[model samples]
Target: MKSESIVVVGAGVIGLDVALVLAKRGYGRNTTIIAEHLPGDTSINYTSPWAGANFSAISASDANALRWDKLGYAYLLSLAAKDDKDAFVKESTSTEYWDEMPSPAKIDSMAKYLKNFKEIPAGDLPSGVAYGIEFTTITLNAPMHIRYLLRKLTEEYGVRVVRKRVSDITSGFLSKDTKVVFNCTGNASRDLNGVQDSKCYPTRGQILLAKAPHIQQNVMRHGKDYETYVIPRPYSNGNVILGGFMQKGVSTADTFSYETESILSRTTAMLPSLASSETQILAAFSGLRPSREGGARVSKEVIQVDGTGRQGVLVHNYGAGGTGFQAGYGMAIEAANTVAEELQALA
Candidate 1:
């Protein structure tokens, strides 16, 4: 049942996970990861390395979306439990605040898998918050974990990597042997040739890294107007990220002083320990979250391979926005299954 080789474009978290899943599912030796950016490369266009990378999701209403959330949550929990340093996931705590109390249905549904889930008492709540939930969660050393994936894909799983820019599917298709192409290009799909999906857009997020060793837990406040969070990079020494705003369609990388101060004011207020004199600012930056107007697209299509007469299957697993890290594996599993089904039909 072995088919022709496959090509995977993009090396971000979503793409890497997709490659890893494909490798694990018996497509190991024939897959190649081609991308403009790889792990350890920093660019405003690259979002995975800059993630808060926590294992929490906003209240997802769609059952399929919720299933992805739970699947990813469980996968991450397993990694956190493992003692491997390269995996870089560790058990942590999450306390999420809401400006108004969520529906009873919402709480009940989320609590089903939120280990150590509890409603924080009103007396302990900070001002300007109406409802809060605390649960056991996990944080990732994102960069380290991504590099680990790349290493495992190449060395352990026999997958190959070609770190190059794919100008477009027609001109940049990596191989003639490729029977299926997975477009995990993230937000780059808006301009990718042969598939410029207008639904793709960028949600710019700003962050400030701080030396806050005393702060070990994640805290977030969600409101109709805004959202703010403090996430500790677990294995990184004394580092935590304070962020942010999802300014849709904004691509500028400017980190304004006022915006920086605003992030500092809001995040430190949530955790007074962060404002201590011992804490020092390390860096400030921004990245564009790859977003689609109607959530992520994990569907399949039969299109001309490299604009040639020969047709091939193309599976898309991009446009995850901020939810990419949390629901990535779930999406990858589905994408891999789609690849399998398409190959079976071709057979």
Candidate 2:
């Protein structure tokens, strides 16, 4: 193994972070990132840009998931510490209301990892809430975060980025001798050649962006299969994200008026002023979350390069669903470690 040539098949936050970490580990120059779309471009296929990118341990009950969140929290905290310019991420208070009580083990995990985690007093809990918790978490400007990641990979780390559609994961291969390949193609894996993951499915998320600078904190309400959240953008003339649904197997580009109205109606109850004319509601759009059954696939797999006799280390890092931003760093670190270990073993 030369520890020189590598390929990552997407440019979303997950792929970018994986490339960045590998670059830092001395795979800088020869590493190539191939993607159909790059940062600053708008498309329904690109989900990270449309995210209300924030940190929440709502998905961190499993030990592996919690570990990823923990690593991400520490890394995100470092960004918040030096965010005098509000470049990457911002720290904010997050209050979550659940219609059904989460298991005590889940609450304990949040308490152990989340900053200033606490159970909301019964009097403090809002109506229709069976459980509540308050904690400090970090929110990100999704667009800025991805662009910054791209700059770091190209400028700071000398990683190469290619803009082209790949028919399959193997299309990103630069050379037959390539020691490692990362599959970060999100939901594309379902139809993606050489990786038709039948379990990979799409979950559509709808959100409304409004100018609500007065709202500085994050609020989330979960009931049965539906969820509504209010996430104020870090520093964007008071733009807040109001959302959403996890409609499985739905990937239509259409945005319905009733869906927007429903979001506004439910969210306005939490922040009455959001209904006022003073708060201008901007765009209403939807994107597909690349969800997989049985959670994200974050492991090492060995495989032959199709027709080629040579084999390479393939690190699976996609299927994060909506938790990509919250758990990206940890997953990147874990994937990069595997690349390093395998490269050494092959060498």
Index of the highest-TM-score prediction: 2
The global C-alpha lDDT for each of the candidates, from Candidate 1 onward, is 0.83, 0.82
Question: How does each model score on TM-score?
Answer: 0.93, 0.95
Provide the lowest-lDDT 10-residue window in model 1: 169-178
What are the runs in model 1 whose C-alpha is more than 4 Å off? 1-4, 103-106, 170-173, 306-308, 343-347
Candidate 2 residue runs with Cα over 4 Å from true position: 1-4, 83-86, 345-347
Q: What TM value does model 1 have?
A: 0.93
lDDT of 1 by residue, 1-347 (tens): 22237778899999999988888876878788888999999888888998887876453446656777788888888877874467888888999998877667667767898789998999888888899999988788878889889998888888888888877754334556667888999989999987799999998988998888988999999877677999988888879989988888999977888889999998988888887998989988888899888788898888776435877778889988887778888899988888786555443
- Give every collision pair in model 1: none
lDDT, residue 127, model 2:
88
Estimate the lDDT of model 2: 0.82
